[model samples]
Target chain A: MTGDGQSQARPRFEFRRNTWILAAGFLALLCAVNYFLQDNFFEPGVMVSNLTTFTPLILIAIGQTYVILASDIDLSVGAIVSLVNVVTVSIMHHLGGDALAVAAGIGAGVATGLAAGAANGLCVAALRFQPIITTFATGTVFAGLALWILPDAGTVQAPEPVWRTYSASFVGVPFVIWSLGVVALGCWLYSRSRPYLTLMAVGGNIRAAFGSGLPVMRTRIAGYVICGLFCSLGALALTGETATGDPLIGIAFTLSSISAVVLGGTALSGGVGGVLGSVLGAILLGLISNVIFFAGTPFEYQNLIQGVIVLVALAGGVFVSRGGAR
Target chain B: MSAARERTRSGPRWYRHSLVLTLAIIVVLFAAGETLSPGFAAPGQVIYLLVTASLLGFVAAGQNLVILGGREGIDLSVGGMISLGALIAGNVMDASNAAILPALLATLAGTFALGAVNGLGVTFLRIPPLVMTLGMYGVIQGLLIVITRGVPSGRAAPMLSAFVNEPLVLGIPGILFAWAAFAAFVIWMLRSTAFGLRIYAIGANENAAALSGVAIRRTRVLLFALSGMCAGLTGFLVLGFSGNVFIGVGDQYMLPSIIAVVIGGTSLAGGIGGHHGTVAGAIVLVLLQSILTTLNIDPSGRAMIFGGTLLLLMFFYGRQQRLRV
Candidate 1:
């Protein structure tokens, strides 16, 4: 009934044929550069701190990978994060900063993220609004809602246990490290699943996929939903990190996530690349910022230099992949 | 047979004219404004709306041109270009206003160069227009930061300030005159010029246009450059209107310009719309903004409503397309 039947029967298990080798290499290079730029770059404390910083982006970028792979985009992911963060903090504050309240807040945050994703999905896939602009509009709505919920940035001290557990280690390993492992494993399992292939097919050619009996709309919508879910996770991580509700917190994540996806070698046109590459891309971006800061570049020029580096990385990835493909 | 059905199903002659539909919307919005507050119909208020719309009109003109150039053409860098242009012009123009012309020229030239880079990447390198322009957006923004060192300084030319605020003729604001002249020139260029026809032809069907000997690559590149120039001009106007510059001054224009074009009935898929419609669309948005302000809606509520309106408009436009199909 599907092309996957024939492809699955083949002897070669060629998963990740389109994995972003260039991005992985670039990330490695940046890691090496960072090692030299910062003192004690490999120290456990520094590494944990760095990984914690990269975690939320890693989560968001991974979700964005699904949407981009389905040949769509979700600019609203950052907004979803903002909304979830504010909602989580507000809920906790309202319900009192207890264990049950924090748990309930987390649940509420996840629900809000899912709802936003569903709204974007319905508009883009069901309504057939242009993906980029639709998500952009929806993103503005989400950001507005976030601001409305928390008129301004403020701190809501989570129950000590919440931040403690988030920052603490189990068996001498940081909690973030364990969370990263869980996320990586989840992505790995999902990549091997049927829905992932369906998403890839839909992105590769929507008409063709539909003709072949794939649930095109459903797959695309699911991609967005998953993206929203991951953004919620990112928000949870952010809450742990900042313990605050800032309507403006996730604004930078929007472009940065897109950059990470592209930097991971996911074609903006879609149907290529994977989460692994996006993870590497996210790390690369984080490291680039770190290196800039450590190198003592004027604080003002930091963004300028960072932008230049992303462009260079993007161009390099494109050139290398095109060269390799040819 | 399907094509015939599409033609018939397009309904009345007025329905087929998106510009008419947009104009009708403008009238409706005006009526709503009047009903909500009688002062909305005042000549002064109308003039204010047109003047602000014209500022947005400049940016939308460039955006419309790029969108009309096809192949998923969109210039996300317009906002950055606007900011860069205003910042550069503000910093360069001296107190005596002697350097105004040169500053304007330099800003436009700089913007043109940046747009050209985007054009080159999209056309030759086969980069998606969105990504290329977005990358350029980042680059321009970074350069702006580096140049301004975070704090934007300098003043708008006094002449520009006078021109913007003062009435030039018959109680009409001077900026309206500038907008009218610019709009007329753009409309003429788009309607009567070979380049304009090429733009439309390429947008309608790039492969077909190429086969028919349209300079697809050249036209697209030029269109982006032109869009950049429009942004530069918009920046100059913004500086004049505001009497100074800031890092985020141009931030608000990016999405609104696209919204104006979209509302104007320019298909994001390209081809099938005109600058005249965009003019109406710009006015409509300005009118809506004024009404919202008069109602004293919070900025967040305003943003949400604006976004919701954009989605609704897109949904309706998309439904029309689907029905035609």
Candidate 2:
């Protein structure tokens, strides 16, 4: 089994080698820039806050990595976040915000995310809808359902103990750090799993994978399911941060996650990237935003600069990878 | 036999006959509207629907060209182009109508230049059309924000407003005449010209067309430029209609334009549809909106319906082909 796995993964590892290196180097550079620009960037408190800010996007980008690696895309992840956030918050609110209610709400939110992912997966992998447009349409549907559930943004304070546990540290280590550790470990383990390789194989060449006796449809569907699960987790993280439910909160996640995935050196063409790069990519994006904010750029020009930088980063990543391949 | 072969070659049996489906849908939507609200079938209401549909139709015309140019061609920047065009034209036009022509020309030229950049990125740099146009959307949006400082200040030129709103013939708006002429021109360009033929050939199969001597790069560039110009023109029209320009004036049209093209039976896979169907599509969408509005559906419900409809349409049209383009 080890030999079989090694043989199957070798070609992909070769394709992905330089991207991981580039992503790591770029992430380090971004962190260094942020440290210099931010007066207290190295403080544990500041670092914890930054990590908290980075956590949701990191999770979403990881989920997105699976879909993109399978040569499919999910524009509806943001909508799933929106839906799950609303559903969780609403449930907690209706249940009077008790500890048990909060637990139940969290479970419901995860279920909503899984359900949305399953819908998208069925449409793309089974029903044969175009991935981009299908997801775009489904995103609208999810967003609408969210709006229906909560017609307006509302604040529902979870029981004090819930958020306290979230923000609080166990044994002088932050809960966020523990959460990140668990997430990272989970991703690492999954990366080495057979299903991950199957997804990569399916994405690299659907016909070839099919010929090689891979369950192409199931692999693609599983990618979406995994993505949905991560998006729900991101939604939960967002709930912890905001303690509020807004149907519109996750609108920015779709493009940002896609950008993070691309910036992480994952080819949009699929089959040649990993979750670790996406984690760094999400951090790099957050750090870039922070650096821009701290550098005293006018508020209006910030969006412009960010847009230009993302385009440049995208173009640069594409150029470097192409050159390396040649 | 040759004719039959050509028909089969062009598209699937249902697609070749999709115009009938579109017309039938439009008729049904109209009937639904009439049943829901007695005033809906009135001539004034019909004219209103046509005028609104004409705006989307113009944008769809350009979008059809880009989508038809193949290689997964799409332009997400249409909304940005429309906004930028309107902003430029609105700012340039003083109370005096004299500034209108120059403003219109400048808007066209500026937007075309931007579209050319998208074309270059897609064709030369090998950026996927999706990412390239999305990036262009961001750049245009950011530039507009910076230039306008989050507040747009300008009134529509008097002449433009008059042309757009005033009745030119038999209680029909003057804009209808302009729309009619533009539609005629687009139809001619797509069907009766060498450029049109090349667009079809390239959309059908890029490598095959290129090998057969089609100027793939130039045609693609022109296609995107044309999409930009159409968006620009819609911008000016929108300014005339609203008598003002704002940051997000073009936001609503982007998805609707794509929906219009797809409804008209133009394959997202490229090379298998035409502008006429898009025209019908725009009308159908407008009529659908009218019906939805009359039924008093909330905005959220409307969004769900719109998305659900798009999914159903795609499933119907796309399921025939198993291979993902």
Candidate 3:
């Protein structure tokens, strides 16, 4: 890997051997703090509610892990979430809120998500457009489409049962937990699969990967498709949580999810991290916000505080990982 | 790495013709817009668009330099800087004519310093520019609410608004002259100055530039600072033009400034574009915007059109000819 004389000169962040360890420690620390700050912090009912709130970020961050692992970024996933949410909610509304309608709605929503992912993939992998800018543009388009479908927040709503099922429990576990578990597990299994390894090969060194006869373009495209799939899942959860088709709701999730991805120990540079960290990172982010709220931070300063904390965490990770080498 | 080496000094033939192409776009947009919207080319409407275009031009100039500095050079914090600059101006001026100088100084100093921090993170801490600026964006956004107490305050001094909105000479807005002065300085620096050359060298090939004795860190930091200062200037200008400010004043310009740079034919890959095209690019963007405005599409439609146009423009000339081929 270090054979390239040219790459020797380029500085790479020497991340900790296992970032999930750091994530777990931080998560534990936060959980302990929550125990003191709030009553019944560990109660299954309260925990499930919190996890429910955390579901979308957790799922989207996992999806982002794939793209970032491939050394590409998707700025559009949040917009995708918004678009899917509106699409799902709208379809359900128009088709009449029965079980059949919900099925159709979710199916259509997934299609929208896949379509967005394909657009990003084609733009970057096929056309070689810059990932950051292309995704930004696509995200803008997706958001606009969301707005077009749902002109106003209250114009359409997911049927009561649609959301009820989301909030409802199954197999002795909450729906959020079940969904989060399934998605996170999929990410875990994929991380060990050949396709995931191929993505890493591409990300670690695109030229080398190409030279080795890897399906460089197709594998990279698959990463975005996976991201899109997760974004659609995120939208489903969000629609359930909010019970409405709100075009603008998912905008903030973009930055927050990125933060979670980084915090989870996934390198923005790609090929060096996994979904486990992202999952924990998303939960960690949720906990940080919870701590801020529990600490009674004024509404105006909550966002600022969370941003500062995340930045410090990022800078601190880099600083520590460098470990006096600098 | 080989992909980068493939880029020779002589760009595609179209690179040489970008300025002409940009001008042609502006013309076509004007003709089409006039035909579709009636009165689209009226002198008053055109002047107003140029005035707004100038506002965006200032930020795009900054974006141009950053992109030129290479290493994934992009200042995503620009939107935040613009918003922060506006808030700083609003606070320092507090609606008083006498406070204008102080407001200008504070906005410049504050944003420049903040931007430098971004550079330090990128250079010293080795944070990716996208992640660094993206984080900075969040911080600035949160600071916006805190600074504004959740609502913006202060008004544009009537005198300042006159300078921004009213023609000062030959029926041209004062802002355009101001922008011209700034653009002239920027262009001259890029073409005539050693500092300009260093950024270009650094962007073109960092290791080579470093081996050749260029001070990479200082130049990189300086570029980010300059970008911040540019965004700050736009903030004050925006305040003057609107006669007021808001938490999201600079948000609108975020994509447009980058779009302007790209549309102007500045390659996002860095090292291959210039401010002259960006200036033309700014005008092109405003013209397209005007046409879209006249299209009477809802906000959603406008956004989709803008995004669609960006994809087409980039696909046409900006992308690497192909990923594998």
Which candidate tops lDDT?
Answer: 3
| Model 1: residues with Cα > 4 Å off, grouped in runs | A1-16, A319-326, B1-15, B319-325
Query: Which candidate tops TM-score?
Result: 3
Question: For model 3, how does the per-residue alpha-carbon lDDT over B139-169 read when each residue is reduced to its tens digit?
Answer: 8888998888888787777777888999889
lDDT of 3 at B167: 85
Candidate 3, superposed: residue stretches over 4 Å from native: A1-17, A317-326, B1-12, B321-325
RMSD of each: 4.5, 4.3, 3.2
Worst 10 residues of 2 chain B by lDDT: B1-10
Clashes per prediction?
Answer: 0, 0, 0
**Model 3 lDDT on a 0 to 1 scale:** 0.83
Interface DockQ per candidate: 0.38, 0.38, 0.52
The residue pairs found clashing in candidate 2 are none
Estimate, for each residue in B57-110, the C-alpha lDDT of model 1 and write its tens digit: 999999999998877888888999899888878888844378889888888998
> By TM-score, how accurate is candidate 3?
0.94
Q: Looking at candidate 3, what is the lDDT of residue A322?
A: 31
- Just chain B of model 2: what TM-score? 0.94
State which candidate, 1 or 3, has the greater DockQ.
3
